[model samples]
Target chain A: MYRGLLWLCFLPSLLFGQRTDSLRIDFRPLLNGVALELEEEGGASAGAREVEVLRFYLSELQLLEGEEVVFAEEDHHHLIDAAQVASLQLPLTLPPGLRYDGLRFTLGVDSLTAASGVFGGDLDPTNGMYWTWRSGYINFKLEGTSPDCPARKQRFQFHVGGFQAPFNSERRVTLAIKPARSISIIIDLDSFFAATDLSQQYQVMSPGELSMKVADRLTRMFRVE
Target chain B: MRQGVILLVVVMMSGLAFTLSSPPGIAYPDHFPTTAYDFRAHPLDSAKVQLGRRLFYDEILSADGTISCASCHSPYNAFAHTDHDLSHGINDQIGTRNAPALFNLAWSTSFHHDGAHHSIELQPLAPISHPAEMGSSIGDIVRRLSEHAQYRQAFSESFGDSLVTGERVLKALAQFQLTLVSAGAKYDRVQAGKDTFSVQEQKGYQLFQTYCNDCHFEPLFTTGGFARNGLRVDTTLNDFGRMMITALPEDSLLFKIPSLRNLSYTHPYMHDGRFRKLRQVLKHYASRDVRPMPISANEQSDIVAFLLTLDDRDFVFNRNHGFPH
Candidate 1:
């Protein structure tokens, strides 16, 4: 009698559903052994400042398996400061006995978001990610002060964006996470500080092609761990 | 038994959906050009349009709750402010540019005097956030709109249970503007060969064809492009039109060519409203000394007559488009 009842329950459960898992994304910005240059002071370390931040937003997250993008979320620009690494928990219901081996996501918002109109909450321009005079959002914003930087005394800002062609820029990276494990992405400041010539690219507050270069260079630092 | 219940629910849902998604009232002239806005991206239901219409006239959009879009763009004046040369906003703050008449904007490629705004869906943010304009942020507007029960219900109906967002707000404004089609003009009748222009109007048409038609185009009466127009820069404002966005020196002094469809209703022409009357505009064009053209007195008169024909009386007095109270 018990076996028959168990079968009755198992039959419908087996026919209708599958197990689900949550994916966690962790972000980290590296600081050690990097030549951190600020715009205000000339050729000095950002470490000299008591408190400094290199913050930016990661938007339009997606999960990819091979060539196919499985999950896509547009208009989500989560700001990650030097203090807290931006993380997201996504509940996913996969096929029966299926395991996702890889994931892909863009580091910045796509062109469509920049072109779309005023959005409220996280997507609003009041968040400081938007440029009012010129239309377009800053995909990545790098702010801090270093003794080496020229604009050291005042708060220096490097907000990068501009999706229009000839200046379009937003970066994406893909990683393999076998067994479908949650991953932490390390944004090595060393790589970014090395790639950009701080003297020429110190205080960018608007969107344009130069900003695209900075964002492209920053995306190269993203890796799965 | 569960399957039967699910089936009943699905059937009920489908019937409800059909009733809510009924077609909207969008009658327009057969001769008008196709609308440039894609309604499919942001579909227009009467509820959303009505909500947007309320927001358009509500003074609560301003930081002080005293100035609304209609404050500068009045429906009685065909949505153009006539009290001042430059538009007045919150705190009686005068903007540097004239408030251009708003109508038939569905066909425009861009917005603003310098074409800084590329899409209709994003245009309201300019006025809403301008320091000299409404001076309110989109976040505050959404929060304020959310407090109202009517707006909440309208938003739910229009956006399928979505929250009141700036995107939805701007999209709704776009929906209302898209319906502002003005094709029932005397010129439209002439185009259909139902009526003929007087001799003076005919002469004006010839003059317009020779000079003004190059920039003002036809039917819509606007090429929707920027031009220098040979106007001297105001020392105080020193507004470098397209250069503000392009950052190119060659594009300096370039301003959007205004539409001449409602010339009779929209007075004080030019970006700054320097010319109060049509005669002044004609005289300016006749000088030709400005743009290196040769417009004689006779040609000037004809062009002015032709400009008057472009007026659409049906648009200015459309009862369907008056105050939404």
Candidate 2:
């Protein structure tokens, strides 16, 4: 009778479906080693710059085991906003008892989805990720204020996106990993800011040579901690 | 038995809701080509169309709540402005190009004179965010719509919730535009065998088929392709139409061909609205640098007569397309 009672309990759980676990990717915005919170001044290591906004799209997240495929999010496009704490933490639902040794995700939205028209949720134009005059998603947006920047308000804006060929900026970021409660990923902004000459190369609002290079450099800043 | 009965009621109620909320079938003439807009992606609903119409006429879309889509593309003008040659927008600022007419838009593959926008869903954002146009961002507009009680209710009715999202707003706008089909003209009646064109119109039709048919294709009256029509570049504007978007030298001076439908109501034609009369347009075409037409004065008059047949008064005067009362 006890066994049958336990089976009844198990039956309801089975009805719910799937003995699954989720992998949480914790994205930490760091100026070198220190976390830069909001519009707060980056520490001495970060060249006294202040990051106002940092948002980018992480799409088609997948878990890989060597050459074998483990899990794939075929149509997933996640907008990771540094301002929104929850938006940075990406949780991936996994199949039961699945084991993976590697992680792979596209750093930006694909050209097909960019051309497909308006979409709701994270991909929605309301998210402020889409370009208005030109039809395309701004895949990686980083706006900040630096004393060295030669803009009107000392503001530096890098809205990196170009889905069309010859300047396609979407890049795949694959990181070798080990299974754990959460995957720690750090976006080192210090290196990103250091590489640019803020005086001349601060503004990148449209798709072209500058935005494409910024997008390429952006894909390299994602490091597994 | 109880479960089955509940399911049946749910199904029936859904059917009832669909029948009540969705408008009647869109009646396209048999001669019209397949729609460029994939309707299967976002099916037309009456509630959405109504919601879109309200938004279109509402000045709240602008930053200062002074301008609306109808401000430039009025219903009485066949959705194209007449008071100005160039588009007028927020803060009494003038725009670069003419506001194109808004009818039979479902067949359009691209938006803007430059074809910068690929889809209708993303087209409104151009004017809404342009500094000289509505001068409002999509983010600001979403917030404004969310705060309004009537808009909230309308959104709920249209989309099954009070979520004033960019996608919903854009989709609703697209739905309303797609419903603005103008196949009720005398040209359509002639094509449908219900009416016969006058002798003058018939001769104009032959001329139109011979010379003008390549660019302004039949039925929809637009090939929906960009062409370099050899109009001298406006020195003040210095606009490089298709080349501005593509950045290719070959695409320089190429502009999206405007539809020939509703030429009477939508006067002051051309991409720049340089010609107030059809005679000037014909004259310019004949004297144009590229592929100049050899049309004469009498031929221009006959062509104008045939062009007048393309005007559909029913479409321009449709009460459904006007501002929401």
Candidates' RMSD to native = 6.0, 3.8
lDDT of 2 by residue, B1-325 (tens): 9999999999999999977765354669999997887776667888998998888998999999999999999999899998578988888999989889998888888888999898889889999999999999989999999999999999999999998989999988878888898999999999999999999999999989987899999989889999888889999899999877766678899999989999887878878888899999988888887778889989988898999999999999999898889
Look at candidate 2 and tell me the lDDT of residue B223: 94
Per-prediction DockQ: 0.32, 0.70
In candidate 1, which residue ranges exceed 4 Å CA deviation? A1-23, A31-104, A116-130, A144-153, A173-180, A190-202, A220-225, B1-25, B153-162, B288-291
- Writing each residue's lDDT as its tens digit, candidate 1 over B1-325 gives 9999999999999989976766443455667676666555655677667777878888878899989988888776778887568998899899999898888787887788988777777778789989899998877888898898888888888889858877788778777877777777778889888889989889888777777788888877788899988878888888889877765678899999888887778887888888888888877766645665576777777677777787777787876667786
Question: Chain A structural similarity (TM-score) per candidate?
Answer: 0.74, 0.89
Poorest 10 consecutive residues by lDDT, candidate 2 chain A: A40-49
Native interface contacts kept by each candidate, as a fraction: 0.35, 0.84
Worst 10 residues of 2 chain B by lDDT: B18-27
